[model samples]
Target: MLYDRIGVGYAHGRRTDPRWLAPIVAALGDARTVLDVGAGTGSYEPLDRTVVAVEPSAEMIRQRPPGAAPVLRAVAEALPVRSGAVDAVLALLTVHHWPDWRLGLAELRRVAPLRVVLAYDTRRHADFWLVREYVPEIARLELSRPSAEQIAEELGADEVVPLPVPWDFADGVFPAHWRRPRAYLDERVRRSCSALAQAPPAAVERGMARLRADLDSGRWEREHADLLAAPEWDAGFRLLVSRR
Candidate 1:
């Protein structure tokens, strides 16, 4: 559906950033079987685990690299998985995309004793330079979605950890280029982010035009010199780990 339309070249831009992998794997604990819900291109699936992926987008499924976990063409709201079939359930940066995230969370709980979710906190994202200065529309778009706190509360999370984006984060998700404004100018990079891809064309074009002008005039660098020197930034990503 949405991904099939916008996820054409997803794999090229959304590779697993090892920085993120460590925490996810650690949160998974001793889980031998993991169900990766909305496993886009299977980016963060653990190689050592018995992982089964669930995705609704054929285009995204097609992009899964060779030797990736077996996938079922299913939506998160109604996972085709048995009750307590897996040791853990991992939903990474995908809950917002679900039509009914509550249902998805319920399914995750039903399928495993442990649930790990990576969610976005719009309040924190509002402070990100890109959203603060250029694309306020992205913040508006995220408002209707459940926040990281809400997800944590719904799942009764045992821990809510902040996930900061490294200066050179390998993944091309939104806010990955907080210090590297030039990356947003690239059409490929913008298209890889769902917010940018789904954002109104007029708004995106207007923001990009302003961002380009700011870069050309060195205003961006001058304003964010401190951020340029910083190693990483909290772009509102949070990891919610729950145990039954």
Candidate 2:
């Protein structure tokens, strides 16, 4: 499915979570040159580095910060940079949208000198209240996105470090809001989410209604009260710091 208006609102909701940022940043491993593939609105591009970004979306490119990389209107499968020009390559929450997976991975491998960092959610955790009760279609949408293991192997890494980062919606961010459950009810927050942001009107209505009912009936609390006190959830957001 094509990206919807969420691309416009993405900067608001899909922020650069610091916990997630640490791993992606550290994965670059002292690299000075970087390429942000599918750099949506320059949300996660790092400063103080020689960086370039590739994106085909015009609106997204327009949203780039004043100092962000000189974005080229290019697809990930076909990059404009010469081989080995960048020391690091990063793609956040975007690989899933690529129509061709292997070609994109091949492109990254050809250009990146050392590291390729990524953050993705592939597992459709039906157990997640947001997924289970509210928007199960997202789980189905994720099936098109390649798995992290596949990405690791594509980058030719013999070892992949899978770090578990959990977000509790109640923490007021990340995993914190999940424990609160009410965050998902907000239309603004939902608009920030690409999955629901792209959903059909009927599907969004149905999903939100179910989620509201669950929250009101205390079913959400009863089922996940134990998690409410807990700090975070293993949301399948991971860092794949692939090294040559």
Candidate 3:
């Protein structure tokens, strides 16, 4: 799988962004038991709850910290747990990676009474400046991934919370560094973001060269300086909350 190949160092750049945690935790409500589907490195698995993580990538599972939640090597389409076995289930920024998202979502609904997913609305990908200017290929790839609305409809989501990306967001997802364009130049940053890792090397190189030039020439700053003062920006991320 793509994750098993590039997910070795995922934990280094994929820590939970505390700013976004509030909404996730709140959406989790008072659930006592939770299943973390596609739980890469156990990021965002609530410590307060009994979290059994479901991860398909052994490399990603190996990267989980020592004290992280216990994990089961399984895919979201077929959870080992029985129907309605957990209070809640979480699929954080992972729905797009599922080979069978519809089946995976069905498994989530079957395994728990409540479902929470942090997913991107691909329709809004073009609105992001980085995708628009630097890496148009990311947008092309995003077309294959289901949009947030599609996922919400599949899950019968009662609420879709907008997960605004703070200027200095801690998580290293592709859009997390929107306000800090220079972060894209860092190899470790790109390594952790699936978009850049999966993109054609030639395309990535071309985008990076343009980005580097823009930064060096102050054109990037001049064009996006307004973002520096903004507290946060909406990058089409949404927290889909549903109950069976």
Candidate 4:
């Protein structure tokens, strides 16, 4: 599994952020049962609901905390549950990793009356400060991601809401610590972000060196000072909701 090799200890950095949960909880909309596809480390599973998780990576499954929902070793393309078996299905930041995302969406639609997906637009991510300034290779990485529009069209989504990342976002997902540039220097933080891990190691080292130099000289702070005052940033994250 991709995560098993590069994603060990992911839970240490990638815990759920409360600010990102309200929208997800609301989208659930009275659903008694939820199927969390690609459920990694059980970060976003609502404690108030009956939740079942489907995950392919054994490493990720092993990382789930003591009281997390039951997880099945399965891929999204072929869920073990029956058609309409759950009230809602949630796929968060995991669709782009699917080997066959369209087929996976069909499986989610087959098993639930409501589907909610958290996705990103590659173009928007390219404009982010980290990618634009430090890692140009991230532009290529973003290009490979399944676009927000593509996912919305596939699911026939009824709502696509913007999900701007908070400056102090607790989740260790990409670009979450936009205001805290130093967080990027931490190995654990980068380990949880696939974009950093996937980039060539030498290129990553070069980017990090440049970033460190910029921070020491106050060049980064000077360039992005406006971001310090902003409460949140739009990094192209979107929530796609579909109800049938």
lDDT of 2 by residue, 131-233 (tens): 6666666667666668776776676754455544454321122223666667867776776666667667687789878878988898878888787676556
For TM-score, candidate 2 versus 3, the one ahead is 3
> What is the overall TM-score of model 3 with all chains considered together?
0.97
Clashing residue pairs, backbone N/CA/C < 3 A, model 1 = none
Candidate 2 yields a Cα-based lDDT of 0.69
For model 3, the local distance difference test gives 0.89
What is the TM-score of candidate 4? 0.98
Q: Write model 3 residue lDDT over 116-172, tens digit each, in one string.
A: 999988867755787789888888888889999999999999999998888888899
Q: List lDDT for all candidates, in order.
A: 0.91, 0.69, 0.89, 0.92
**Inter-residue clash pairs, candidate 3:** none
Query: Which prediction has more favorable TM-score, 3 or 4?
Result: 4
RMSD of each: 1.0, 2.8, 1.1, 0.9
Candidate 3: how large is its RMSD? 1.1
Expressed as tens digits, the lDDT of each residue in 96-197 for candidate 4 is 999899999999999999999999998887777888888888889788878999999999999999989998898998888899999999989999998888
Q: Sorted by TM-score, highest first, which candidate order results? A: 4, 1, 3, 2
Residue 95 error, candidate 4, Å: 0.5
TM-score (C-alpha, index-matched) for candidate 2: 0.87
